[model samples]
Target: MPKVPKWVADVLENVFSGFNRKVIVAEINHLHPFIKTIKFRGDLSGVNFKPGQAISIRVNETNFRNYTPSFWDSENGVFEVIFHLHGNGPGSSYIDGLELDDLVNIVLPRGLDLYKKEYEYHFFFGDETTIGLFKSLKQVIEENGQNYIGILELNEDTMHYELKTRYGLDIVSSSINKAQNAISFLQNLPDRVWELWQNGSFYLMGNGRSIQNFRKALKEKGVNSRNIRTQPYWVEGKIGL
Candidate 1:
């Protein structure tokens, strides 16, 4: 076993505790296409996360995906994650055979997961793969009566993941051909969500190329680059995330 020093142990406990015996209680595909929500039966009292950060899950070092925590009902001891099934990669393939009580490893959640502390509006742009982040953000903003627009892309009929939308959310359809659709969404939105890109920081997570285009679209409209934040799930022409 690997021995940890005292200071390191406390930091790990504060930052992340890779509890060796974590298990899955249930796993199901959601209403949205190509996404699956995995529910875990773990010790929830130790769970902690900000709005947009995620945990890096690993079957092994090579087989891991940064998963955004989709929902957290701490009192009920439940937490969920939404994932997109794009190929036979670490995240999708690993999720396939997950049965109740299956054990797995989770990297402690870390990042600057933030939204507006004081803002009137918010908007989200992402597809099936980025929906995990979208779901978490939508819930927080909606409860505060904030404005939101979520752009989602998917294939014809792949189903996975569930979003609790009170006022509901705007879902824009998209595909790998992001340039074409992104252009359309930016030009025609009068009801803009500024919290994500104003004094408050917005988070971006997904394929690098698509994110590049999305950033360009906003920049052309004269939005500041500092206002937009991104975490790339995959880059263009790359495999296994």
Candidate 2:
């Protein structure tokens, strides 16, 4: 759990900051008939943040989850996160019923120190759940004037994202239910994943099983475990009553 923010502490006993800081609204971008980029917006004005960090959201007392930043300018106080709807989760529920100007409560961004300088060619991979982190990193990498590689695994319907000129977007094909099929896609990696990592590092966000498989595969190919940084976007059996 994150330390409660200062504002909402008065009303919140288990959380920091008692007030609604983000005032979130959903930014729906329909890439195709099924692939939708639901960008969740929070108040980011004048806030300087490291790329690839995530904001923990408390949808209500009963629900709270973390979200990576979507492709948007963090410094300008505007942030976005994109996720494919799987139904029944609080995050999904709030996003489904979101209006243009509803205020949502959120915590400060937290995660691994993504702005790490050791990496050469930046690479990010995960399902639609990680779109926000991908988007946030894309902006930061491009803004810093560096070239990066990013592969997004999403349902064919939600394959829509128009990045700034400097960012490269590659969408992988998978079934509508991404949890299972996306894992298969990465397991095969179509082509060149092993060859591509010879000189740089990769940041991965995936399911527990997927990450386990990915680690095993990387080690078999002589890729150091330290060379791969991973965090699962959703683990099997985690979301529940």
The CA lDDT of each predicted structure is 0.62, 0.60
TM-score per candidate, in order?
0.76, 0.72
lDDT for model 2, please: 0.60
RMSD after CA superposition, every candidate: 5.8, 5.3
List the candidate 2 regions with Cα displacement exceeding 4 Å: 1-15, 18-28, 32-46, 72-75, 155-196
Q: Residue 203 CA error for candidate 1 (Å)?
A: 4.2
lDDT for 79 in candidate 2 is 63
**Taking the tens digit of each residue's C-alpha lDDT, what string does model 2 give over 5-93?**
44554346345564336555656665433335555555666555677666766665555667766655555456666655666766677
Q: Which digits, one per residue and each the tens of the lDDT, describe model 1 over residues 1-241?
A: 1234556545654565544325465656554446667777665566566777776665433344567787776566667887677777555677765767787666656777667646565656565677767778878887887765555544455422333252244444456666457568667766444324344444555767777788787777777777777767676566544
Give me the displacement of residue 229 in model 1, in angstroms. Answer: 2.3
lDDT of predicted model 1: 0.62
